[model samples]
Target: MKVGVVTFPGSNGDTDCIETLKLVEGCEPQLIWHKSTDLMGADALILPGGFAHGDYLRPGSIAQFSPVMREVARFAASGGPVLGICNGFQVLTEAGLLPGALLRNQYILFHCAWTHVRVSSNRSPWLEGVEEGTVLRMAVAHGQGNYFADTETRRRLVEQGQVAFEYCDPEGNTSGESNHNGSVDSIAGVTNEAGNILGMMPHPERSSDPLLGSADGRVLFESLVRSMAAGAVGR
Candidate 1:
């Protein structure tokens, strides 16, 4: 698998994503520059987290207009597997690839902490082997990681099984204080209608290694690799 990680002007998580991809056998990771239009034959693409363009004009608003994002949009439209982390999720929403927008944290603070997210849906290959309600420990670092969508859209996402992950307690309780960012329905991640593209606020790449306090995030990458080996579609 050739996994490409796009590096925007201020993106800081590209290297982390590359290293995480390297941990998976048969995975060749490529670091693509934001100015480059070509994805270099990537089987999957990751838009890692960071304050792209210094988060000017509100999070990903400026970065979404970068030259490479045009190609990213095209690749996603073709059913290619695309994963967007924090700022990347903001970019996806700004680019209209994902349904909802990311708002600033309800507490208006840049939160950096370990969080537990439960696998909420199996509609995408990214969760192929992860059982529903399985809690994964990951780190979330962002000021605008809160997810927001209109009521109808939220309902549609749930009904269509597009919800991928939800902020929850270690025991898989999604209510109350588990939702630190105050995201609607505690949504930590969600997939596009076709389940090929995933946008989430958590940094799974950062939590993929044992040295990172938790290896729970490995399940997602492992599942993706297995899915690819089995010739599974993102759907």
Candidate 2:
């Protein structure tokens, strides 16, 4: 599998995302520049975390207009798999590739720590191998990771199984202070209607290796690889 890792001007986790895909999935990692129009024939694409354009005009507001995002948006429209993490999630929302918006943490402070998220749905290719109600230990570091959506959108998201993950306790209970951010319905991640695009606030690349404290994140990456391979066979 060939995985593309997008690197914006201020992206800091590009290397980590690249290494995780290469080492864990044994897939070819392509470094895609934010200014380029080419996708390098990537089988899957990842928009890693970090402050794009120095987060000058709100998290992903500036990065959404980059040249590369044009192709990324096209790829997603054609059913290509796209994963956005942390600030990347903001970009996806800004680019209109995903629903809802990420707002400032309720506490108005940057949250940086490990938290548990339950697999709310496995309808997305990114969470194919992950079981519903499974708890994953992942790290989230961001100031605007809170997720919000209007009444209808939120209801449709749940009714359509677009809600992929939600902040929860280690035991899979989705309530209380377990939600580090004030995400609506404790949502931690969501997928597009087609289920090919995923936007989440947690940093999966940071927990893909057991040495990094947890290997649960690998489940999503591996699921992507498997989904791509299956798609190739179907084609």
Q: lDDT of candidate 1?
A: 0.89
lDDT of 2 by residue, 1-235 (tens): 7889999999998999988887655588889999999999987889999999999978999999999999999988888889999989999999999999999999898999999999999987788867899999998899999999999999999999999999998999988599888999999999999898999999999999999998788888888877777773121
Write candidate 1's Cα lDDT for 1-235 as tens digits: 8889999999999999999988878789999999999999998889999989999988999988899999998988888889999999999999899999999899798889999999899777778878888888999998898899999999999999999999999898988699998899999999999988999898989998999998887777788788888888742
Local distance difference test, per candidate?
0.89, 0.90
Our model 2 lands, by Cα RMSD against the true structure, at 1.4
